[model samples]
Target: MASDVRFSDSRVGVSTPLDSLREVLGVPDLDTALLTHALTHRSYAYENGNIPNNERLEFLGDSVLGVVVTAALFRTHPDLPEGQLAKLRAAVVSAKALAEVAIELQLGQHLLLGRGEETTGGRRKASILSDTVEAIIGAIYLQFGIERASEVVHRVFDPFIARAAEMGAGLDWKTSLQEIAADHGLGVPRYVLEGTGPDHDKTFTAEVHLGGERLVVVGAGAL
Candidate 1:
């Protein structure tokens, strides 16, 4: 846990972005180039000499992180309701959480930014840090696989997740829906079961009605 991470290319055997990620995360087998793609911001790429951005890895990382956090939440809190578990997972995987992890890993210093992004203080931006960190996690999983990525993520988020577990249930989708209805100056929403699918594979369709008015949007899910 070094306090101040330097961006210089002087470290031994740390010539590439994956090397930088490995050095920073204390995990080997890191594809330095992929990690480079992870930390690379679109702005930096645009400003730099035709360097690629991190959007693709960011997308993959977002899903990977969601799965990781959801699985962790499910395993850690068996007694908690699903809604609460989802909320807890949401909090755990929030941008803020990712940004904190980025800071802990000293990721900003290692970013290969373009001169414009660097000048614009992109490294310190929370959005950039959060996205970059997720991208890195995605890249790490792709290179090192699920076992290593899970180990690394758990190693990073253990304490926070533990604290959240101690704190208890967090997700409440129904409540959120209710809140939306309430805020929209609508009366209690009436959920009408639109249709039921076949016996083998049942599907539930729900539509919310506001003030005796049917909602335009309908939701479908496996029962």
Candidate 2:
């Protein structure tokens, strides 16, 4: 889809309209009006009096995204300390991360921007895209249920989780492994560890599953 639009007309033809988002979201019958509202920026709403913008929806979606990511992180990394889990959550929910997801979905193309915003390149702005993505999530949650919203959240964020793991970003190898699993649309990696011999002279073996291909890693440590 085309990423840039001209501001010559007040209403630019979005190359990837709300209907095109259906395939990306995996929701075939999304409500057009709700999605349209999600795409409307405050500037645009002000210009077109009586039309609502996505601020409220963005507020709700921010909460919805938090719950979904928090739950997934909690469930997936049972062995991870609270600090690590929180860090991972923060990374995934960061505006930069959401903006990347919006870019991947070509959501910028679908945004409804005011003439000034359009001329100023608001379509390519990270904040606008991220907020719009959140608004869309809110719209989905209001129309569907938490279950569907969660699914969309995970689906959109899986690849990002993988990238996070690859970067390490202060996370341990085991945490990275679990994130990798989640990235591949798989359940969290399950780790099995065993120790043998005396505490002072013990050998430990650890095994874990990672990735959609279900790659397994085994390692041994002795003290």
Candidate 3:
């Protein structure tokens, strides 16, 4: 909402690395400066003499995400109760959910983190990744207003919302699996996660076990 904000390259151009990211986000005209601000972590700012960071944008984006997701759930599920809607919203907007979306966008590679954070594996941290997603959303809102922001939000988040809806009263996939196991008297489901490859391009394999038997194994590429 602040019109006076400025960045070295205020207008994003084809020469910038962010041009590809802008294309992925379907917001080709987004200000490069704003996008850079959104990607800047506090540690990066602190290391650089307290320059601006993404915290403010993250805050604005969190609210925008909540509002957009809530409206979508309300309109899309007119027959659902308030409690169910709340659960669906929670599932779609959770930190883990947002982090998954961030991973899909390959956002970590583009983040601006301090050297210390980089050494400590900050890129894979769910909090930072999720916060960055919010910051980007905030940047979009600031640049284009809620209408355009809503369009982007829907594009990225609608599938997750629909998936959550299909989970019925179980909310997320984990909870749905748990409920199903409980109903079948299969005991609790246990998850084992293993990561392979280098820090920058690790692949994760998750195995779900029930009653001491491995039920499924799923793999995901680097975040």
Candidate 4:
């Protein structure tokens, strides 16, 4: 599979190569055109003469992802209530979680972006990365069918689902912390957030306070 062929975005005169991406996705036989479309962000499409974007595919993929995740959760955690199951699904399918998966797959490098988006660090944006993941799923489903798409979804998301199940209420740290604090008669947990740097690239610092005493301060850079 010589996957290194260039698909040109004519308006921007940009060429996106999919060889590395195909290997990373573990879907070598995916149709090049479909895969290219999956990687095409709206910014890129708009800049390149308003060509089709990945939004439709993202929509389709969202449904596919939901079904697979829901079915798996239903089957595996037969004892869980509906509320817990919904929470588990939300945790796994959230933008943050999907973005983490995209980062692991190095999907950022494969995104097709416009000049503005590329310069503004759109590749690392959680929203774009997550949508792209879904678009890829849509492409896989269209090309290969539901069974193969489910395999890919499981490969990327099963660990997240399992961790969410294990964590249960802990998946929502703020709520979990508040509950623990309430039980311990510590009043309520207060969170103070501070953001720094440019809007396109920012670093966030969070402080957790209990009983008017600051307990933890942690900083994380935005992706």
Clashes of each: 4, 0, 0, 0
Error of model 4, residue 9, in angstroms: 18
lDDT for 197 in candidate 2 is 91
* Candidates ranked, most accurate by TM-score first: 3, 4, 2, 1
TM-score of each: 0.65, 0.67, 0.73, 0.70
Candidate 3: give the clashing pairs. none
* Local accuracy of candidate 4 as per-residue lDDT tens digits, 129-179: 999999999889987889999989998888887887754665676776776
lDDT of 2 at 122: 98
Best by TM-score: 3
Cα lDDT listed for each candidate: 0.73, 0.80, 0.87, 0.83
User: What lDDT, from 0 to 1, does candidate 4 have?
Assistant: 0.83
- Summarize candidate 3's per-residue lDDT along 175-215 as a digit string, tens digits: 66776688788888998888999888888888888875856
RMSD of each: 13.8, 13.6, 9.2, 9.7
Residue 143 in candidate 2 has what lDDT?
79
- Evaluate model 3: give its TM-score: 0.73
Instruction: Determine which window of 10 residues in candidate 1 has minimal summed lDDT.
Output: 3-12
**Candidate 3 wrong stretches, greater than 4 Å:** 1-4, 7-14, 171-223
Model 1 reaches what TM-score against the true structure?
0.65
Residue-level lDDT tens digits of model 1 in 82-197: 76676787778778878888888888888877777788887888888999878877777777788888887888877768777533334454576676677687767677886576
Off by over 4 Å in 2: 1-16, 165-223
